[model samples]
Target: MGTLSGNLQRPVIAASAVCIASISSDFRDKFWPNKSSDTCSSLEQANSFSLPNSLNEPKSSWVSKISVSKLSNLSFVTRIRIPVPDINNLIPVSRSSSVSSFLYSSLTSSHALINAYQSAELVKAAKPASYTYDVSSTPSEVLYRWHLPDPKSIDVTGSSDCSSVKSRTVVVLLGWLGAKQKHLNRYAEWYTSRGYHAITFTFPMSKILSYQVGGKAEQDIQLLVNHLADWLEEDGKNLVFHTFSNTGWLTYGVILEKLQRSDSSLMGRIRGCIVDSAPVAAPDPQVWASGFSAAFLKKNSVATKGVTSEQSATIKEGNKTTVEAKPELTETALLVILKKFFEVVLNIPTVNRRLSDVLGLLTSQQPSCPQLYIYSSADRVIPAGSVESFIDGQRRNGREVRACNFISTPHVDHFRNDPKLYSSQLTQFLDYCVLTCCTSS
Candidate 1:
């Protein structure tokens, strides 16, 4: 129920010919545990409505039991009054015609829990005192300007060769959802310091939600990759990926899909990849829900050691006593309920929708590049076993795979927990990739 409430907060216009789709009874039980008659009546009414020409619009297989009139322009949102069965009337949202569609598309979600990271504390803390980078954007891509260090900074007098220092490599860093610029810059700095050009991209909450509902975000991803490919080809630069969380993994999975099917020689430009805390083949439904809630509430801050303790302290900020703050009122409870909805209720099917299952498709189609998997057993999101299994599979496929298992690092916080080990392993991996993989076909 909380999940539904969170998603519905934004103003969404209901078509004049509204038709209620079939929702699972189990979903109702979980969403509205109170078992109210008004809710059921609302569901019934919603499912019964049928409009003329409602069949013309595309219908999701899961939602095909009922027919709804298609809006003229799905992208155009407006204010409308709609009767919600058990709840109060939905307030109509108003926006100016002058506002750009892109901005509206990106900021549509009004869920506080999901958008909490918009003002995350970590972003402020991670901000560098000084930095320099050029920024560019296309309809589907955002590119940050970066450059290699001067070759004169390093000693080539006694070295056999210095072309590696002179040659520029592109490091694509895809940050997790709600990740702030400051947080990502910290990671990009590592590459830039070592004469590698770093380009960072962040997955916004609105964009991620599109993927959840099987929207056309994949096409946008292709556009972004095409933009990068053009640049890499023009400059003759090797490519490396540093990805954080499932957002990055899913984006890369799509890239791999295109690579395997197309005859584009661009695939050969990818030298290696370092995946950090991602590619969850199968996630625990409850944990998946909780992980999203926690990430959103915390504003995309990577969980670290003592985070649980920190949360326990913050949950007591209100005047409510520990007893008054019952378990049912906690974030965990809200997420468990939401999990039931995402996994069981509105499980819309889409082409290549393998996210809910295993990532074997991704691993199998993975480009023959050196791969490094970094994870921790303490991560509440990606399971350590899944990471290991992926590594084992890659090895079996005659691919070079490396693993850096931090004993207690939290999700996406391996670097924060142990900087030395993280840096050493990553630098070594890149060095090896540069020496062998980058020079290959």
Candidate 2:
């Protein structure tokens, strides 16, 4: 009991010291302005206060200083009053009060002043890390974030220190299934810093599922394509595609198909493309199943998975255990065998079937634009061999294609495996594309 009491008192002592130091700084700054530089320096060094471990709670305060009276009179007093909850009301600072109540009240009052300063500091820290805006699309809303290039960096006309600023390119990122906004925001920060407006979105798998087996165009894909096409027509912004995983590839396929069909100026606006761990020509059914399980079952909680209406009804009928068992399939070798069954017996096309057609179109097309393909040799989902083959085909068709192959990097995780290399390579790819686009323009 004595040790605990001593431990508790330590925080009170430290907070009292902080309160004194804060008051001392106020006195020095206000009353001792005429003091010598050496004196002020010494006072500052003396005013530095260390905090105790227990009272290191997040600092919060509404006010820092309150002047009750001017210093001209002895009755005049200037003091910093921090707002803390009334212990009488909250904890009842009396004999009947519990130990927890006393502890809470003591800790609260002790850190009241410092907490105010720290709370203000915390609010400053909590300010938006970056500026972002969102735009809604058909089927589901697409979140669009703008990373405007630094005006000072581009203001070459005013500053002699400025180098030539190339035209800003708008990067469109199509993220994989189940990607959150914060996940893509990190990618956006990279582009914004390097002078690119990055527009990012995720494809709705429910809508993706509505499309036919042969990568057929459905209303969902058409709606997204139309939305993008309209945006393209509004401005002649040089557009670049940064695709992640097979899901992104599927969306890209739909976009390319829409661009090909529409009379809009979108195709010409497309300057370059960068595919990350995608364009899998022939995806294994087991791998696709594993990816789906990871996205729907393992990653999401049961309440939040947004299971289909039919699946939800089925769950009500007592097949919940069977549904729960899907994630377990994520571990078993039987998934590979099941992939063959789904493909051969059920005659179901892999999700990449439609995307593979788009890959073919990219390869066989005239004036094949510069493209950067990033893949890993050890990706379990999208085989590196498929990406290599696609690149080889593109090369044969006289397309300018570059491939960054990493050894043993997992699917859609090359960035996490080595962020420096990933970022540098992406910057290089963007630079090359910018130069080519400028020259072509």
Candidate 3:
């Protein structure tokens, strides 16, 4: 797409006297039919007069009627002669130097109108087309929505500096296990509003459970990775990964593996990563059970349900009150069943090997970019200790690592419990990443 400044440089064609006369006549007939045709004929006759070679020439220098008819037959004049009623009165009658002045003024006004139309078209062109996917019919399908920054949020200028253009950072939001496109929209909006492109990706639960090493999900992920690589190559944009839960974390690992194998240079464009309630670093049956239980049971799942202050309090005698500490979540029957099921399923030779491969890649092959881990001590799905251990490993690998523990938040509920704090952390991390990128460049 062309820049807004480039569009404004387009030349505007001036309307000729013959074209203006025709448009005036048509407009008057349509809006003021009761008026006599005398005025129309007079306008035509006035414009029919030819200009003298010098201003001192006689006023009797009249052009033939045939010449006026040929001037009216010019292709561009007919094309521009729309019945613009608003400009009917702006049509000058006397064919003096004033006619040239009027053409300049009219073209000037039309230029602004054209520019507004071009700007609207540009914005519309930047919008992504609608996408539809059915996981039931296509189980391997991975769906995503791309959101571009608002044009109004960008500064318009004539400068050629690349930094002055639209934002070159794209934030990829990978949703948790049962997360839907709608669930990730709010997070996408948070990034897009700040002039960055946001791409939200979520996998269906069926696809995740039945995953194979070279299955349909892997095919879909490969395609998505290639798309991101192409985008980075075309625009020289950087990427920041924002993942939720272990499912998203593992998916990020798969993407990293694909990038490392296919195009290693693409990995260098990664600016930062913000992992939310994720990265168990190893395949644990209990963690898998907890994550799947939260995805399946939602609010009813003990692993996901939050304990409030009121629920944790107990009444005392003599009108005195005492605060009782929150109790640990008990293992429900469903969680027990899921844990046992995963214990057997995870032990299968093929499953064990595949999981180990991806986990190994994640632990060692990750890009050396800044990472911010957002988790909570109260999150039952992915333990706080596991996340802390992973962060320490990353630090030991010489990666810039930051961690925030929302002490009482549920799994993947850190942002919802305290959005202000969540947003502040994201903002600070993003700003630092962008500043570092600029300095390095």
TM-score of each: 0.60, 0.54, 0.63
Look at candidate 2 and give me any clashing residue pairs. Answer: 59-115, 59-119, 60-115, 60-116, 61-116
Leading candidate by TM-score: 3
> Largest lDDT belongs to which candidate?
3
Worst 10 residues of 1 by lDDT: 110-119
* Steric clash pairs (candidate 3): none
lDDT of 3 by residue, 1-441 (tens): 013123323321122355455665664343233435332333223322223334333341222111322222223223343221122233333457744444444433332222222222223233321111111111122376556564444444424233332356778899999998889978987876666767788987656655666877788687568557655654456889999998889889889989989889889989889999988988899999888878877877766654464432322121112322332354477678888978877887777788889989878878888899998766778877899999999889888998887766788988888899999999888878755544355
lDDT of 2 by residue, 331-394 (tens): 4544555465445522334434554566565556523458989986555566666898888987
Can you write out model 1's per-residue Cα lDDT over 1-441, one digit (the tens) per residue? 234334643522231112122222233333333534342233224422222222223341112231121211111111222221111121122354422332223222211111121112111222211222322122232323243333333333424233343244668887775675567877877776665656676665555553432345666555446445444433346688888887777677766666555535777778889999876665446555655765666733334332343443543342213312122355556666769856753344442245642255566767778899998665666766778887887899898888887645677888877899999998888878864533342
Better of 2 and 3 by lDDT: 3
When sorted by lDDT, best at the front, the candidate numbers are 3, 1, 2
C-alpha lDDT of residue 120 in model 1:
20
Off by over 4 Å in 1: 1-132, 136-166, 212-216, 234-236, 260-263, 299-329, 351-358, 436-441
Model 1 lDDT, full chain set: 0.52
**The CA-based lDDT of model 3 is what?**
0.64
Clash list (residue pairs), candidate 1: 20-46, 20-47, 117-299
Q: Please, what is the whole-model Cα lDDT of each candidate in the order they appear?
A: 0.52, 0.52, 0.64
